[model samples]
Target: MATKTHRYRRVTPAQLQTISSLAIWIPILFAVFKLKTGDTKFRLFIIFLVFGALVDSFGMIIYYFLSNELFDYHEVFQILYLWYECLFFVWLCFFFLNFQQKIVWRNILLICFSGLFITEFILRIVISSPNDTYSSFIYSFFLVTSSFLSAFALLRIAENTGEILRYSWFWILSGIFIYCFSSFFVDMLSYTAIGRGIWSIRVLANIIQYGFFVVGLLKMNKAQ
Candidate 1:
């Protein structure tokens, strides 16, 4: 009975939910890539996406091993984590820019983000000191800017169609705003008193951030 209870407690509902959601996101991102891009780019982007996922998986595995002396590669995992993060932004740029439009605002916005994307790539390679600080700022800027743009786009659609997505960009933007601002301070706090390791607060922040996107995606799938 004690062993049974321990087994049940080890695999909690939240972990199960996160796994299920991530599983769903994988297929959804693949489908979106298939429908939106050329065969070559879609395939290449998927390769990078899956590779990034594997890097994250490997980091988790390495961390597990490190904690138990099963193996040790914490430094390697840190480097891979940086690569994983860089690829995520690159993937986002590819995903959006591929869906081109003649619309003036869309073109303008893409151009702006394209410049920022290039900067991020360069910074990823060149900026070495206080790497986390720079990365956090870049990511925060991306999230906050993307959220504003999404909100604006939704508003434009609502104006034209008289129907907006339920919970829609509002929820997504709120999530972005919350995390972007929260993470700025989280980074600052890490430099100060927190000692700079992964904390529960960061975990919770990420959950809320991704949860917002998941809910928005579900609503979109339902609407379609």
Candidate 2:
């Protein structure tokens, strides 16, 4: 008889952190876009995030009313969640073009995120629901990877300017750190009976993360 081998897959805490950081990007993207653009051209994107946020929150609210092992509503909620999830990457791409950096690595990262979005779109179509395929690896990867690089660049800029504390990078970095760390618990919570409770933490973290972005935006306005 031949021996059989079993393969196991795992997501590291660090990876989970990256994934969780995605929650904050929705609001951060909105704040930055509103700050940068004056016209109504990108207004639709802003509305998308707002609508997605509302849909996601509504889904959470309805989750509490669902019965065990008979979540007929889950299917509908998952569809909305998947759609809401796509907005983050779209905003990230828009934000990247407005970023202050002009380096080869940044360009490569932008390209990678764009490619990931395309892959994610296809995956969403194939899966069609969070229950079918909820990992959202590509989205998490893009958000986390881009955040890491952007945070580093901002830190460097802060250092070179000799005004680190005065710069917006400090707040942005702190927000990213908090958002990333919270993602691990959020992911674990998603699979448990108490998952919704943990997801509440994710919402709190998002609020803080977006607050930091708002602070950064105000700083930019002051510098102008």
Candidate 3:
């Protein structure tokens, strides 16, 4: 859900470090190809990918160099990332609402969520903890759960239940759901001893998400 773990500023193995950095690009490359084929649906996803790449790249790598000279900028970048990620996921949830009324409610929820995000960001800085893991956990839990429910609701109302699996959005949402849901758990567990060091679940969840994304993107090609 966040770099709450500092992207494991602690991984010693070069192979794993390389793999972790590369994992995000898997979905980005697929999304880029989809956009190249003239599919506009993935355009927002493209932006999401690019933003994520920048955030993770700078936060995980560039920050290391920064620590040598300037002060570490934890409050802004990571906090901004957490806020953006939450908003994006919530908006993705909004995209799937099949009914106008449901969409309206989601809009209201979006506003509320935005306000909440702002509040959380401020709290993270004010709090004594290095990372506001608790507030972050709240965001991940709420947004991911809401998005999951939105997707589930779509499944319930879909006329062509059998064909639902063939749609690109379904798999994409499912991948996001699985990834974010796992992240929510990771955020919660981070408060305990079990959450010490780097958790493989984050890496595993990320790969699984993009794996489903590859399937989802391929389905988009087929649909065209």
Clashes of 2: 0
**C-alpha root-mean-square deviation, candidate 3:** 8.1
Candidates ranked by TM-score: 3, 2, 1
What are the RMSD figures for all models against the true structure?
A: 7.8, 12.5, 8.1
Candidate 1, lDDT over the whole model:
0.48
lDDT to native, each model: 0.48, 0.51, 0.66
lDDT of 1 by residue, 71-137 (tens): 3344444444444444443343333332335355454655665565455555544453335565566
- Name the 10 consecutive residues with the lowest summed lDDT in model 1: 90-99
Estimate, for each residue in 85-113, the C-alpha lDDT of model 2 and write its tens digit.
44443333334343345455445655665
Screening candidate 2 with a backbone cut-off below 3 angstroms (N, C-alpha, C), the clashing residue pairs are none
Q: Give one digit per residue, the lDDT tens place, for model 3 in 85-108.
A: 666667776665566598677777
Pairs that clash in candidate 3 = none
Q: What TM-score does structure 3 among the candidates reach? A: 0.74
Candidate 1 deviant stretches above 4 angstroms: 1-52, 66-136, 157-161, 167-178, 194-199, 221-224
Q: Which regions in candidate 3 have their CA more than 4 angstroms from the true location?
A: 1-18, 36-41, 63-71, 125-133, 150-158, 222-224
Evaluate model 1: give its TM-score: 0.47
